[model samples]
Target chain A: MMGQTAPMREAAKHAILILGALIVIIPFYVMVSYSLKSPREIESNTGGFFGAQAPMVDEYCVKVGNPKEDCLETPVIFNYSQAIKKAPLFRYLLNGVIVTASIFLLQVLIALPCAYALSKLRFWGREFVFSLVMFCLLIPVHAIALPIYIMLAKIGLTNTYASLVIPWTISVFGIFLMRQFFMTVPDDLIDAARMDGMSEFSIVWKVMLPTAIPALLAFAIFSVVAHWNDYFWPRIVITGDRDLYTPPLGLREFQGDADGSMWGPMMATATIIVTPLLVVFMLAQRRFIEGITLTGMK
Target chain B: MAVSSKNTGFWFVAPAVSLMFLLLIAPVLVAAFLSFTDYSLGNQGFSWVGLENYIKMFSRSTYSKMISASVTYVLLVVPLSIGLGLGAALLINSVRHFGDFYKTIYFLPVMAALLAMAIVWEFTLHPTIGLVNETLADGCGAWTETVFSFGWIPGIDGGQSWYSKGCQDSFPLWFGDKSYSMGTVAFIGIWQAFGFNMVLYLAGLTSVPRELYQAAEMDGAYRAWDRFRLVTWPMLGPTTVFVVTITTIRSFQVFDTVEAITHGGPSKSTYVMMYAIYEKGIQQNLMGIGSAITLVFLVFVLLLTLVQRYFVERKVHYA
Candidate 1:
C-alpha cells in the first residue's frame, strides 16, 4: 500500500512539473514561431499552428516589403536583409561591443584590487570603506542620473560614449561580488606568496586571480548582460547620432518611424539582439547559475 | 612581508576607490546641492531657492499621479513576481528529471536582453496581430469588437476593431491609457523578473532539510496548506526578505521598460520618478528640478531600505 501511494505521489509531482514547464515554454515557442512567420500571415493570424493554415514564406517576404529587389521569396527567405539595410546595425553592434567590453574590462580592473584589499588587507578604515561600498549598492542608479547628466554636460561629455561607459565602469556590486569570492581563497596561499618575496599585486595577479577565474567569469557575464541590455543610460547619453545607437535603440528606431509598424523586421531585430546573450548563458549555464546564487545568498 | 603588504594593498585599492568616489559619491553630493536650487539647463547660472523645487513637486497634480503609479507598480510587481517565483521553484524542486532543462527554460527571460524582450513583448501584446490575442481566441474562444467590452471570454464581437487599416485604431494601447497602463507595465515587469527570483528561491529551497518534510508527513500533515505552512514557509524566510528587498528597489528604479515600451506615455501615464528625472534633466535641460526629484526618490528608497533591513534582520532565521 505504501509503495503504491509513493508511486501515485511521484506521478502527481511529475504532472505538476510538466504543466509548469509548459507555461514557461509556450511563450518562447510563440516568439520563435512568430519570428519565422511571414508578415501577412502574422497580420492575418493564419500562421498559428492550429489556425486555418501555415502561411508560406512568400507571404511574409512581400509583406516585409524591402525596397531592394534583391529580397526574394523562398523557403526560409525573409526581409531581415532589408531591416539590416534600413539601420546602421553593424555600427550599433560595434558600439554595443565596444561599450560593453570596455565597461567590463574597466570594472574588472577596478573591482579586483578593491575586492582583494577588502578581503585580504587590514587597513585603518577597512570596515568603513567596505560598509560604504555595500551602501552604494542600495542607492538606486536613478538617484544619481540627474546629477551625473548635469556633471557630464558640464564637462562637455554629454552625448559621448564616455558618459555611458565611464560612470558605469565603477560598480560597487561587482566589488562586493568579487570580495565574497576572494574571501573563500585560503589565507595560507597569500602568506606563502608574500613569504616568497612576491609583491601584493603579484600575489593578486598570480595567486588569487587564477583561483578566482570562475568568480570573475561569473561577474563578467553579469556585467556584459546588464550593459548590453541597458537602454536607459545609453538613450540619455547617445543622442542625435544614429551611428551610436545600440541594438535596443536601433530596434526602437525601427518602431518609431513612419513605416507604421514593421512587425517582421522588428521581430527580426529582436531575435538578433537577444541571440548572443542566449548563446552565452547556455554555454556558461552552470557558472552563470552559480554566480547568480552566490550574489543572491549575500 | 607585513610592511610590503600594507603598501601594496593601498596601491591596489587606489584606482577603484578614487573612481567610486568621483562617479558615485560626488554626483550624489552634487545632486543633494542641486535639489535646493532653481537651476535650469538654459541658464548659465542659478540662484538658490531653498525648498522651492520640493514645494513645487508636492503641489503638482501630475507628480502625485506619477508617485501613485510607481507605488502601485512596485506593490503589485514585487509581490506577484516573488510569489510566482516561489511557486515555480517549488514545482521545479519536486521534479528530479530534466531539472536543468526546466531551470534553463525558466531562466531564458533573465538572460535575454530586456530591451529586446520589451520590444518583443510589445509585439506580443499588440491588439490584433499579436499572438496573445490569437492564443486567447483559439485556446479560450474569447473575442471582443469593442474596447470597453473586451472581456476575457472569447467569440463576443463587441464592435471593436482591434487594428484598423491606419495606425489610429489599435484598441487599448497598454502604455497609452492612464487607467490601465500601470497595471500593464506591472504585468510585463513581473513576467520579465519572475525567472531571476525563481532561481533565488530554488537555491533557498535546496538548503531546506527534507527530514522536516518527512516528519510532517509522518505526523499526518498531508494537506497542501499544512505541508507548506509547516515545512516550506519557515525555511523560505531569508530568501523572502532578499527577494522582496531587491525587487522593491528594482521596481522603484524602473526606467528601461518605460523608455523602451512607453517613452513615459500616451500621456505620461507610465512616467515614474526616474523617467521624469531623465526627461527633465536630459531632455528638457531642467537640471535643478530634475535633481530635486532625484533627491526625493533617493530619500524614499533609502527610508524603505532601512525599514526592510530592520524587519528582515529581525525575522531572518539563519540555519
Candidate 2:
C-alpha cells in the first residue's frame, strides 16, 4: 500500500512542478517565438509558435525609400538583422562586456590583496578595517545614488564609462567573500612561501590566488552576472549617451522610440541581450548556483 | 618568518580602505548632510533648510504612496518568494527523478536579465492579443473555467468566480490597472527572486545530514511529515534566517521592474523608494528631497541588517 502511494505522491509533486515550470518558461517561449515571427503574426497572434517562416516585407526598409522588392525578406532574417542595425547593439553589448569586465577586474585587483591582508597578515587596525567592510555591506549602491551622482557630477564624470564602473569597483561584499575564503587557506602554505624568500605580495599572488580560484571563480560569476544585468545605475549615469548604453539600457532605448511594427526585432534584441548569460548559466548550472548561493555560505 | 618591519598589509589594504571610504561611507554621510539643504549640482552654494525635506516627505501624498508601495511590495514579495522558494526546494529535495531538470528550469528566471524578462512578461501580459488574455479566452469553453471557479459551492455564485468572470469579460489590463499594478509588479519581482531563494534553500537542504532523519525515525517519527518536523525544521533554521534576510534586502532594492514596466504608474501605486529616489534626485534634480529619501532608505536597510546580525548572533544559534 505504501509502495503504491509513493508513486502517487511523486506524481503529485511532478504535477505542481510542471505547472511552475510552465509559468517560468512562458516568457522565454514568447521571447524566442516572437523573435522568429513576423510583426503581423505577432500582432494577430497567429501563424503558430514557430510562425510560417513566411516572407515578410520589411516596412522600415521601405520607409527608408528602398525598392519594395529589395525590402522583402524572411521574418527571422529581418528580425535579427534589424535588431543589430536599429541601434548600435553590437556596441551596446561590447560596452556591456567592457563595463562588467573592468568592474570585475578592478574589484579583484583591489579586493584580493585587501582580503588577503585582512585574513592572513597580523597587523594593527586590521579588525577596524574588517569592521568597516561589514558596515559598508549595509550601504546598497542604489540607495545612495543621489549623493553619488551629485559627487560624480561635481567631478564632471557623469555620462562617462568611469561613472558606470567606478562606484562598484569597491565591492565590500567581494572583500568580505574573499577574506572569508582567504581565512581557510592553510597558514603553512604562506609560511612556506615566506621561508622561501617570497614577499607577502608574491605569496599572495603566487600561493593564495591559485588556492582561492574556486572561491574567486564564484565571486567572478557573482560580479559578472550582477553588473551585466544591472539597469538602475547605468540608466542614471548613462543618460543621453547611446554609446555607453548597457544591454538593458539599449533595450530600453529601443523600446522608447519603437512603434508597433518593431516587436519582432525588439524581442530579437531582448533575446540577444538576455541569451549570453542565460546560455552560460544553463551550461554551468551547478557553478552558477554555487556562486549565487555563496551568500548562504557560513 | 615574521615580517612586521615592512607592514605590507597596510599597503595591500590602503587602496581598498580609501575607496571604500569615498564610495560607500562618504555617500551615506553626504546624503545625510545634504538631506537638510537645498543642494543641487549646478547651483553650488545652497541654503540650509532644517527638517524641511523630511517635513515634505512626511506631508506629501506622493511620498506616502512611495512608502506604502515599497512596504506593500516588500511585505508581499518577501514572504511569497521565500515561501515558494522553500516549497520548491522541499518538493525538489524529496523527488527522486528529474531533480536537476526542475532546478534548471526554475533557476532560469534568476539567470535571465530581469529587464529583458520584464519586457517579455510585458508582452505576454499585454491586455489584448497577448498570451495571457488569449490563453484565458481559450479556457472559456473548457472545464478549466469551471474547475477554477468556486461557483460549485452554494454560497458562491458564478459572478463571484474571478476565473469565469475573466473568461466572460476581458482579462485585466494587468500592469495598467491601479489595483493590479503593484500586485503585478510584485508578481514579476517574485518570479525573478524566488528562483534565487530556491537555489539557496537547495544548497541548505543538501547540507542537512542523513543521520538526523535516522535519528528522527528512531524517535517514533514514522511519517514523512513527522520526520520533517522533528529533524528538517530544526536543521533548516539557519538557512531560513539567511534566506529571509537576503530576500528582504533584495526585495527592498527592487527597481528594474518598477522602472521598466510600471514607472510607478496607474496612480502611482508602484512608486517604490528606489524609483522615488531616481525620479526626485536624478531626473528632476531635487537633491534635497532625493537625499532625504536616500537617507531613509539607507537607515531602513542598516537597521534591518543590524537586526538580522543581532538575530544571527543572539537568537538562532542552532545545534
Task: Give the 10-residue window scoring lowest on summed lDDT in candidate 2 chain B.
Answer: B1-10
lDDT of 1 at B125: 68
* Candidate 1 docking band: medium
Residue A237 of model 2, lDDT score: 90
Give Cα distance to truth, residue B39, candidate 1, Å: 1.7
First chain TM-score for all predictions: 0.85, 0.97
- TM for every model, in the order presented, reads 0.88, 0.98
Q: Compared with the true structure, what per-residue lDDT tens digits does model 2 show for residues A1-298?
A: 8999999999999999999999989999999999999999998898888899889898778999999898899999999999999999999999999999999999999999999999988787899999999988888988888888888988999999999999999989999999998888889988888888888878878898899999989999989999999999999998898999999999998888878789999999999999999899988888999888884554
Task: Give DockQ for candidates 1 onward, in order.
Answer: 0.56, 0.79
The residue-by-residue lDDT of candidate 2 on B21-133, one tens digit each, is 99988988999999999987799599899999999999999999999999999999999999999999999999999989999999999888899989889999999978989
Give candidate 1 regions above 4 Å deviation. A1-27, A49-76, A258-261, B137-173, B218-220
Off by over 4 Å in 2: A296-298
Best by lDDT: 2
